[model samples]
Target: MTRYDFLPRLVALPGVYRPQADTRLLAAALTQEPLRSGAKVVEIGTGTGALALQAAARGADVTAIDVAWPAVLAARLNGWRHRLPVRVRHGDFEARTQGLRFDLALANPPYVPSPDARLPTRGARRAWDAGTDGRAVLDRICEAAPSLLRPGGVLLMVHSGMCGVEKTLELLGREGMSGQVTERALVPWGPVLRSRRAWLRNQGLAGDSHEQEELVIVRAQKS
Candidate 1:
């Protein structure tokens, strides 16, 4: 029932994407959703189930998915420890969400721009390595959102401005949803971003002395 105090109750296994600034921003946006009982929610790319727990605490029926088994375990354990009704699953989101229709969907997927066009197939890198332009996963989510959402359902996703906020809005628009950045925060570069700082600068995603990246939460709702 505590906010931003999940670390102690959460089961932090290796390779799991720990709750970070992006998680907090997306969770903050989630709190604005209608989370009354009977509301169905699906969270793609759930890490430790932070957002899922938040939604469940508000009375929404929350189901969360993560590709990593350890992450799934962690998420489930966190929900159990907190006595929240969050269903955590380990599998590819595309497969897990099949035939699923929800009143709300949430995601804080990997949007870090990497040097390679191919995304990581396994390991810790899978949590942050998006393609060179960083839209590999985001594009897929945009394509799948419409199908996953029920009428009047909404999707809230967070990503770095480096991935092009306008582009995300455009993709969601194409999905027949009205979308926009609803929340933004300037976050100092994390370890991963710091490690890729030089390449990011070369790609013009980062400026000289610009150690911060703007994170945005895009909210899309089906009319």
Candidate 2:
């Protein structure tokens, strides 16, 4: 069973990203953290606020932020339905969370390698379409992590292994935060990746015979 199996059914609205393998992996990692009651937690690109709600149910004060209005609405509604108090807000993660530091930071940012160079500002593509290198959002998250967490605070972020997991660790290390991959699960490529199979293979992000993608959770701590 998943870590969220015991919680009430979540309400996922259209256009908002649905909690999938990455979300489940991050949730499992969250269970391993030593969270005390009333610990401050922030979830960036919160989608339906699944991870934030998990922290809230465990007594952590959670603030969830997303760029889409539909996601913000879905998160607020889900929090009410689950009886979990989460401060769901609609805005960019860095803009909305400025000047705030938390004990724990969670993220499931876009890491898909898209053919397009510019990131999407709207539409469902925004959920998963990163730039050609697939590090558009991932790099930003790693760069902002130090400012988002307090001393000794931890960051739990999940992304596709094709997006350069080692680069993520290196970026965090450069920022003085040590990090390593804590969880990994192989999942079959969904429609998004399947649609770009040929491109991915040509770009060396995927192989012709491979149909599965490895998802990994990176746990980084601020020193």
Candidate 3:
């Protein structure tokens, strides 16, 4: 069964996308890394607390922040269920984490771009919706990541292949961060791709015959 399937009923509500393979890959990277036990870790978009819980279980001191109330609550509930000591809070990554530096930082922001790109609930919209290019939220995270991370800290993020991996790398480079692709897989894009085809076609692309969306895992370090 999927992690979403195993999640608590309350966490299975709308607007909460479950952790996918990218999440698992990121968790594994953190495990393999040299983060000491009780090292400070921050999770920017703690959807369902899957990654945060995993980090906390590995003995990292974790603080998970999400703008969505339900997501924060769900994360807390999930942490409680798993007996993990994760602090779930309702806040944005850039605004809420001022003066906080962590040994490890991770985020799986809403990298999907859509015209009707509003969250299912008002509370959840802020957690999703990355503006027209789908890079708005991710860009903000990249810009603020350096400040949020301690020296020699790491940042792990996942975004779409359609979101321009090269551009993301450029942004990271500009921020004095270096990253490498850790994992990539083609997965479905749900319903947004149906409407996005016209936009692609306008840019001289064809129909929506592609069934898979690219999932890219990037691990970066602050230099």
Per-residue lDDT of candidate 2, residues 91-120 (tens digit): 989999889999999999999999998999
For candidate 3, the 10 contiguous residues with the lowest summed lDDT are 1-10
TM-score of 2: 0.97
The TM-score-based order of candidates, best leading, equals 2, 1, 3
Q: List the residue pairs that clash in candidate 1.
A: none
Strongest candidate by lDDT: 2
Which candidate has the top score in TM-score?
2
TM-scores for candidates 1 onward, in order: 0.96, 0.97, 0.86
How much does each candidate deviate from the true structure in C-alpha RMSD?
1.3, 1.5, 3.3
lDDT of 3 by residue, 46-118 (tens): 8888878777877889999987877887888888777789988887677878888999998888876655544
Regions more than 4 Å wrong, model 1: 5-8
Write candidate 1's Cα lDDT for 114-190 as tens digits.
99898877788888889998999999999999999999999999999999999999999998999988999998888
When sorted by lDDT, best at the front, the candidate numbers are: 2, 1, 3
Give the 10-residue window scoring lowest on summed lDDT in candidate 1.
1-10
Question: At residue 77, what lDDT does model 3 achieve?
Answer: 83
Clash totals for all models, in order? 0, 0, 1
- lDDT against the true structure, per candidate, is 0.88, 0.91, 0.75
